[model samples]
Target: MQTTFENPRYPFKHHSDLNQGTAVHHPVVIVGAGPTGLAMGLDLAMQGIPSVILDDNNTVSVGSRAICFAKRTLEILNRYRCVSPMLEKGVTWKKGKVFFQQDLVYEFDLLPEKKHKLPAFINLQQYYLEQYLVEFIDTQQQVDLRWLNRVTEVTPGVKGNRLKVETPEGSYVLTCDYMLVADGANSPIRKQLGLESRGQVFKDRFLIADVLMQAEFPTERWFWFDPPFHPNQSALLHRQADDVWRIDLQLGWDADPQREVLEANIRPRLEAMLGEDVDFQLEWASVYTFQCRKLDSFIHDRVIFLGDAAHQVSPFGARGANGAIQSVDNLGWKLASVLKQQGPTTLLKTYDIERQMAADENILNSTRATDFITPKNKISRVFRDATLQLAKDYEFARTLVNSGRLSTPARYLDSPLNTLDDEEAFDGGVAPGSAALDAPIIIGDKTSWLIDILGTRFTLLIAIDKTDISRVGESLPELLQSVGVDLVPIFLFSESTDLEVPKGAMCICDPWGYVAQRYQLEPGTCYLFRPDQVVAGRWREFTSDSLISAVNRALGFDMEVMP
Candidate 1:
């Protein structure tokens, strides 16, 4: 059966010149309506900040690009209430397999822990994710999404940024207090500002093809090194939604990129892998080279670069889109707070520091994966083959196999925002500046995930016995509020207790002790979380003055308080 292709409608109705003769000023202007731009706009809107998103194109992504969505990215999407559609439409998988010449070498499970709400990864076409985000943006009154609007020029001024945007009808001038340049790797804005991303570009080329076929293959990542069909090359196969299978074939530097993408050349390769009798239709194909590069700093005065505009990584680990969404998650709350005057602009500086650290980590991992996959010389090839052969027998050798390291959230251990644990000595607990892990909790006959309750603002989480709730609830809120910090206190109690909760704070039962095990809970332990759901500080026992000092430090006010 042949697969049918239905292109999404791209309406070019929102022309900026339509509102001519009026000088328009926006608080925040986001260039490009890709995942990063759309996510940032929606997150800012959720925080009561208005933004205008401009995109030269009027449609979602063209191909099934960036199909792997990590768990952290899903959590960020859940915060916008747009994850349901993705979960419904996406194919969830946690297991992956590796093969050496048609022989199964080893397999791995990404998230062995069943306690979390979301799986380790989901395979959804990028177009579907972008479509869902655009729909969510439509419901948000604070977001003004204008398609077919291209940014031609950007000038940073003392007051704000002066922008020249071109639409199909005409061009118009606009101003914004802050600008987000998410225009992608070949960012015109980055070039306009004379900025360059410094890093290495690998020589190997890869052919990515999306094939629509009905196959009995399980929904797991299948990777083959030196397969019988494609000799001395690596091939990856992954299942996506709507019977679409993403296949990536490694074509060395000498392979003609143009000839490799042709249907005549690609069909034989598909026939050799999946039998010649199997009926399939070509959905999309692209030939590209891998590069690992990133800007020295994501922030440029009033202009902030995000997503592909700041960082670029090889597609092996599925880090590009996942990392970009994380960048949006980190910047959204801080930018909103700074714009609202609730926090100093220095808070935005932390975004550059944190994300640059994340970018560097990604580049390092990607570079390692590239080197292992495509060995430059004979010695490297021998080592790679030896590791693969040994991985089939020894468990320790499996660790050395680098199909891809996979994307994990970057823990900001050295961030300035973290209030270090000076007095406490707990192992494997939720530390300051780390992303908070979720556990299952019970709330009034409803089973809920911990992350559903603790997002969007600064929160004080107290893990205490049911008997101590009233005592802590009586004074903590008032004490924290007096220091200009309005905190929402969440009380977590053990499952055995059935006690009346205090009036000021919300209560939940940690049913399976997952919270206790994960958070390293102790009596009188409390945690302070930032708006982006990263831990700001924690204390085994804290006085009012100590808590106030920690709060000030978390908001970058300690520098201001210094003599």
Candidate 2:
């Protein structure tokens, strides 16, 4: 299939004919339109940034790869104003169940003793999630999504980057200010960039099938090890929205082929759990091995890799897409700040620092999950099964057993981006809530603190007396506006008692609230926060000169913006 282009302009300016290479220019070019790319697009679009999203596939994938959605991801989507419809369709799970030798041994509820604006987890089909995001992107005036276009070659240009993309029509060249590579596990962009990735690919394979069942399996997730149906294998089942159940079977590495496994392998296990008479239709099925790895660097010159392009993790805890979207949430605001020139381009380096920490956390959790499911050898397997069985009787053991190392925002206390003075001032320490990073704090009268404000802009939690506001009010707003910085200033009173309130701390909440800068209230003191929400500079012992300098440093301003 060959096509011709006489001449194209603007977005396709660098395009050549299918056979002849022409050049097209786009401010931002993304390689894949999976959750990460679509998310990055939404983040940029919210800031009114123009970008182009391209995917190799012509249509959305029918296979349900990632079915579990985390609380953190739902929060990021809420920022773009798309979560309403999705929450309507997603199934919320309040608890999870674990079994050993057909005995119900462990049960844990995510909402046991806490209050939160969002549920801990929701089960939604990946296809529908993608549909919602893609639709949202289509509605954005700043976005152009091109499907069925595959990149055959990417050449780093002198100033920017050049990409040769192949399509059903033909091949064209695309020059971009930055290339956000959200392409999946077998990312060609990561390979083309020559970034080294090292990890272990397990020899074992698992058969996964999504089925619609009529039987009454509780909404909670269920898993069985060494069941009568398949004595040596592991069977895990999860209930999804609309009575759909995602089932996975550990089939060792060299188990039966796909056809035989689908036709003859799964019924026995299904019968063991749902009774022999239960009926269900298979939605999708596949066999694949789990992998763990990370890229040597997320940023290589003008191209920044995201999602699976940067790292690959097992599907054990549904970390792949969820973690990737979190990475997007972390990088989006920083990129926007750099583009607007409100912050130094050097601030872009912090994207690597912060997101790389996130990647490391994901890798650790993912590896722990992978090891828990697939032990290395016979001795490891025995130890895992014995520990799980022993956990049935002891409370301490059960906590460790059911915990699964789940997922949480990585702590950024040790980063150089953090202000040393804030750490000393916080009686609670430099981390967000000081609750061992278990759950994010909720603001007073606000339905959300973690998800709603995240992935949008920088936030300033101003702790000041109402009487003294006039002093800071004169120059604070003007300084923020001059730097093109989006600032959210929240006022806290001295006598406020809300635990969720930021307290005597004047803090900065970035798109992701992993770290908040704290300052003990001084009558006139104010702090400037970077787009990443780390403190760029502080105005403690406040003076007009000192405050202006902090603002300058926060915005990376060499010279003050003249009034």
Candidate 3:
């Protein structure tokens, strides 16, 4: 299996528990071996939580499925040092162009900011993503990945969830304190539990054709609506790793999905898009209809659902896998803290609450984007065409244009975990309950990104000036501990030169004032960041008592409404 980014088959190995009559117990067991499940295991491994990942197949996904991974997803994966292989193999890009009737109407840069380590998005085949996750998980002894281990039945329980896994040898009983259901859209686990994902399935089909070709096209996303190449349909062109181009052609509900994927039928379409003289090989093709749906609750006792198993969305925004990864990022720490008794079990409820909100937001956006892409009636199509036409000229109309509202991390603005800003007037910064933004920073002499410094811990980011840093950096940690709160103090300085860490505290040098500019910070500004890199609270004036209350509220310890 020592090859490039291709479909790699894994050898199934027999485990000693196969013949054991009694159920082998584990603290955590993930139901699917897809990208999110593997990542969940890796995240738990980073938290010193061992997990088992069971997959029905022994190979990376057959076709190129989620080809786009957003910056947020990359940052999460980079936490465990597994994103290097993906960044190296994936096609990195930021700009994307939207076309209407063969003319470019608008273009966008997903990440227009500088100083961030990761790109806006990378186009790597889904199989390669899974392969990279599995490869990384192989190195970690905490993750026990069993290929060809299919869960035949799931029995949810109060203490543990019982799963009957059928492997190559025989069936075995397995029990886990927590069961993460990451199985895909058609999740059998979700079905076995008599739960269903509720939402709208658009009445349209899309053909995914991964073609091997040598083309002069730049590495930008090209999406067209009613282009001359396909007459009345939408089409998309993207570059993946290894010269494999991902082409998505929209087919109305009446088209025969089975027949449209044939090489004979797809060749003419490609020739029309690319010139008739274009030489290409069809690597893979599949027809799919997207839906925006999710369960009523992600948490069902000891069994929790993650990714597609809990919710599903149209792939238009690349939110399917990206959202799943973000959920894992949110859950890994909360679950670990609960299992380790660092936080109350009620903290797990926040993951259910927060991720459901994200699922709803993604569904709402995806539903709207789908409606814009495929207008059901002629009147709707007229409005769509008019908007597209106007977008070519007017800036205001460009705002109305909805090709797809590209994926970004969900802002949990109203989350219960947030500590609302009190009477202190604040300008702009990472809002409480929203994910933290990255900026340029330096440590000692070597320059580093802000995200790399915000490790998976409760961070107390103190925006300190040169005058107060020496005193604050040395005393802040002990002061917080005396207040019965533990926080990893990261001092942000506005000076370019390296500062002496006499107390061996974490220091960030914001030479160019990027941190202050990005966070809208003053000398005394302080921000509390959760282990998931989410801002739980921030204050204009720092205080140990206030921070302790905020920390308790963030951990679901204090239910009182206090800012």
Candidate 4:
């Protein structure tokens, strides 16, 4: 359990490194036990994998940075069973208000429908999110968290990866099968890799103050643009759970100075917003700039980039934490498959394509939100203000601006993981990720369908209707396993629906189970999804011998078994 031992190869072994010396070997070594790193470690632990989470910070940031939670992120947290506490400690906002020049401009309510049995959005501080995750990680015996252990350098070794880390006790080396770098925008690991960050950096800086106000502010988020009080400044007042307000002021590029802008200007703006003499104890305040940048690739040999280390979105649409979680979810399963030796090595390349596209889309969303706030030129400013004002009269225009489609999960369309033909192709429709694909059908049950049927291995979903269950069950499992395959058979029970009789069909259902893949009651038809959720291979009217051959092809194995 003690991770300190002397290793001469450590790059930082001169001064502070002498105090600490440990040697550690882990399946996955993660840097920065922040929200992104903790989420990755939690997921890997759930899959029975061991992970070491190391962070240089002595403690989690007490100030609120990212507060809004998207629908996708909530769904992920639910899987780890951490959503309940998060929802309890966080403020849930169903409505938002936007204003201009001290007048009501537009207001909109979040999606009220229970689309996926989760709320639309929740606003909680980033620190609480990390704390809840740390608690959950402590409960898992397989997850190990090491605070104040800073990852100094990462070198891609011939066989695996070599990581140099420094702790209060001393310094040591951590060799791992894979390294996840999540050390934020100024990531030293990324710098060591020499990966260049590409994007535009706006000159404007905003002052953010997290304070508890005596007077009441509406729970809904309120935004102002060029108000009469401060015509040159745009302000945002976000209502937190503990009667706290996170206020952001758009200070001009050439402000007096950073501290002056905060203590002298930001405090007064908050006092004015309250509209009366009120005591506001400022907890934390600082000036931060926005940048729209992304890395060229997320994968570089044994090391993969994650969170702000991979890309940065301006804090407009609140997409940073949500996007980072998605990146981890995308990479988690692929890493598992590669380590388990069940999938091809090339599947790892798809992580870059899928996550980069998602990050690029987030950049666009943040850029658009930034433009709407501080338009580039006079012409754009006029257009943006007019649109916000017109939103009061027109419902359609307001909905367009409020959709937040950029926060949605990135689809795996062009990746080799997708095997849909013209008929089964995604017609601009959302497809479940590998984890959600072929999830068990939970009809009239409170539990998720996939929870019961999906073992910790490959499975086959069979929608059997009057088919021979005994012959299919006994022969298929043995036949598949003989050819280096692990298949679990699942049956779909639907009495009234009309289904054609196909020999082998894999039933695919929507997340809500409206309708999707269907096949007849024939016993020989088969459909397969890779561990990562992409359809690997499909077959119809095949014998036991022939089906084994198909499974082998999907696994990219040439070994022939005595079927």
Candidate 5:
């Protein structure tokens, strides 16, 4: 049961604040060097915003924590230029199997559609992901990743938040216009400010065993409910990089977490699952109980919370890190706009509103999945088993078979930033507030996925379909330019080279008709996407007045999209 991994440790350097004998001010500072904190810092750096990241640890995550990275997460990482290693090193899969008592009842495909730029999910160790982010950050001049630096105290004020950061050399005073609290669920900053993440902490316990070995298992998610090896319990199996397999087995509420993680007890469980003759080495072991919780508000004065510091969910749905990455994606551009004074401070309120709504959705899904996996009562167990028994034969039953509701990009349908469509007859699934979908697009002589270029800016995804692209785009460029707008950039998309758009617009050709078919494009149709790549507004007919209003509304310039 002996296995080891190469965990890189970073060396600490003395900051000038330790000897400056006075407080130093920065635009932004992030606490914790985990995936969330590192992502926040890296995100700002991508936008040319400098940030200081302080962490007490010198190394990345120790174990294969958060092995599942969702498609949305990869896209976000792609923007920061850190997803290449992850795609190269991780195991990508889109199919999943659900088993009832060792019998494969049914299997499902996450991405039934084709021509996607990224896979549905990837399984890689958290440490590997962090290492890649750190390596990429080292190349960017805007990030100051301080190892062994800890935040001993947080003082929030109206203008800025003050932090007392402790380092190996000494403690120093640091202040920032904004303090991003990504310090994790047990956040020191949260406690220092008397904030609480209120939600139910489930009583059931589970053990995670990272097994290392060469095996013939396919790269797919395999879940078992009441299997012979673990009767009356639920188990999950996932293949990770480096011949590591993650197995999660439920141990009742009364199980001894300490004794269960010991090799003596863990080995027997492993044997039961993979026959006694199979060979495997234990890479790591840990026990945990999950919670579906979030802070009352992710924004507290000048302090903002992201990742685990803002919300948490059970691992059953792979919502933890994926949701956290999405949170930062949603916050990064909005925060950058405010920091650069391109938008009002009130725009930050939308982050709290939109992210809290998303947190509720994830928590609800995670709680439901956990409940089905571990039935609370005999009645619930009977119902679950009945649904599982009928799942293979009856298609309707499959919908009720809740192995785990997989994570997807959150749709902020009710977000205040959205301008609800006035035309109800038009439909293509790319409605206002829907997460942007990716499709193969033809640009000039080259071909690329639509998502590769869409998420980073405010886009006017106007489909040509033979319409005059220039007429469709109109004076919208001048409208944005005349608003004294340098913070937000917009791009125009068309189905042909017919985009005689403004000189300011970067035109993209979608000649393959893939993007048109997906978006249900017709003549003179235009969709406005926010900086986070969420559909802010869509119209069956394009007009400069309407597009301008939508753009102003999206940038938090005006309250509504006028007719």
Candidate 6:
């Protein structure tokens, strides 16, 4: 066996302190240039907003951490033009298998729908994702990424928040209209503000080892409970780029974290799982205790929190980075709007509402996964073993096996911004406050995706035929345009008519009615989408007054007219 450990450290760069004597003011100052921070900066830059990003380090993530990139996250990355490089380098997998001892109990597919453009999931190292984002950020002149700069102090202010930063040159003071924090789990800014996350921390620890070896195993998520190699413990295996495999072995509470990460202790575990004859190199190893915790409110006056700085969860479901990216998607547009005065300050509160809800969901799922993987008492272990045993033979028992309910985009169904259904007869599908679903469509002579056509703006998707477009053309476009909102109408052509779409809106031929079926579209139906691609409101028929009200409501305007 040939074993070696290779962990490259990121070099730190020197940055001149901009706030030496005078406080340099910026519209947005983001702390930490990790995935969340970099994504947010790119998003803001795309929206024509300038921001400064401060980071303590100068390189991408050190290890292959947070490898699973969800579809929704991929879509967000696509908006920033960062998804293609990731897809080109990532190992794509949609199938997963669960094993009890040596026998395979069940298998699952993450993405059953094939019509969508992006797959359900892709396994790419976090470092690669961050590097891709950094490349994109470098192209945008509006984004100022200052490496080797750390925020040493934070003070709240009336107009804006002030930050005292330390760099290689010296220390300086800076002020920003808004401060977005995306530091990792142990957020220094979060602690500087005397804030605390409240949640449960599991006692069990997990040893993660990244081994580089050539193997014939398919690129799929494999999990085992009480396997012969590692008895009475849970283990997970997944493939990554460079033929490096990520193996997670559950180490009981009694195991010493320091001793477990030793190469001598880890080598035998790898040999047992991959046979003694196999040659492998130890890429990286670490031991961590599971924790599910989050802040009560993500927003604090002029300061806002994003990513691990706001919430954290166990690594079982890959929720940490995915959820952080979603937070970036949610906050980017809203913050830009508020800063540009297109939206009220109250609009920022919705970020807290929506992302807190998402954080709660992640925490709940993470806690459940931790509990299932590490049963507390004898009775729980008995129930867990019984479920695993029964799942082998019975189909229904497979649902009881919880190997980390995979991460999914959270639909804000109960959001206050949603416009409830006015047409009672319409069929239910992607409703108001739900993330927009993707489908294949024909645009001109080329094939395109619905999401690709729906640019980052307020869009009205109308399912219409030739006859219905005339009626919709009467006042819909002009009314929305008058309010400075581009009503980029996407006409989903119905099969009944060869309609010529009216000017000012793009037309897509839905030959198989995939878009119509997915949206549950009725003739003349309309959907108002926010900049983040969230369904703001949907109606059975388009009315100028109704659409205006919905758009206003989505922008956080008080819809009530004063007498």
| Model 2 stretches with alpha carbons more than 4 Å out | 1-22, 113-115, 257-261, 402-404, 421-424, 429-455, 481-484, 493-563
Clashes of each: 0, 8, 0, 19, 0, 0
What's the alpha carbon RMSD for model 1?
2.1
The TM-scores of all predictions, comma-separated, are 0.96, 0.82, 0.96, 0.80, 0.96, 0.95
Candidate 6 local lDDT, 1-563, one digit each (tens)? 23232333445554444534688888999999899999999999878899999998878787787999999999888888779999999999899999999999999999988799998889988888888788788799999898888899999765799998887778888899999999988999999999998888899999999898999999999999999999999999999987888999998999999999999999999899999999889988889999899999998888899998899899999899999988998898888878888878888888998888899999999998889999999999999999999998898899889989898988887777788785465567788878889998888877888888664677888887676677787765577567555557777785434566667777888887789888898787888898888998988877888788887788788633211
True-vs-predicted CA distance for residue 80, candidate 4, Å: 2.1
lDDT of 4 by residue, 204-318 (tens): 7888877776556667777788887668568877877566677887877776555644566666776776655787677667788879998898888888889999999887777
Residue range 479-523, candidate 3, lDDT tens digits: 756644346777777875456653535777788888888888988
Q: Per-residue lDDT for 477-531 in model 5, tens only?
A: 5666754444233333554454355666656666666777787877567778776
On the 0 to 100 scale, the lDDT of residue 119 in model 4 is 62
Off by over 4 Å in 5: 465-467, 470-477, 483-501, 558-563
lDDT of each: 0.87, 0.67, 0.87, 0.66, 0.84, 0.86
As for lDDT, the candidate ahead, 2 or 6, is: 6
Clashing pairs in 2: 13-23, 14-22, 14-23, 14-24, 15-22, 15-23, 15-24, 16-22
Weakest 10 consecutive residues of candidate 4 by summed lDDT: 1-10
Model 1 TM-score, all chains together = 0.96
Write down the RMSD of all candidates, one decimal each.
2.1, 7.4, 2.4, 7.5, 2.3, 2.7
Give stretches of model 4 more than 4 Å off. 1-24, 214-218, 399-406, 423-429, 432-563
Model 5 lDDT at residue 238: 97
Per-residue lDDT of 65-98 in model 1, one digit per residue for the tens? 8999999999888889999999999999999999
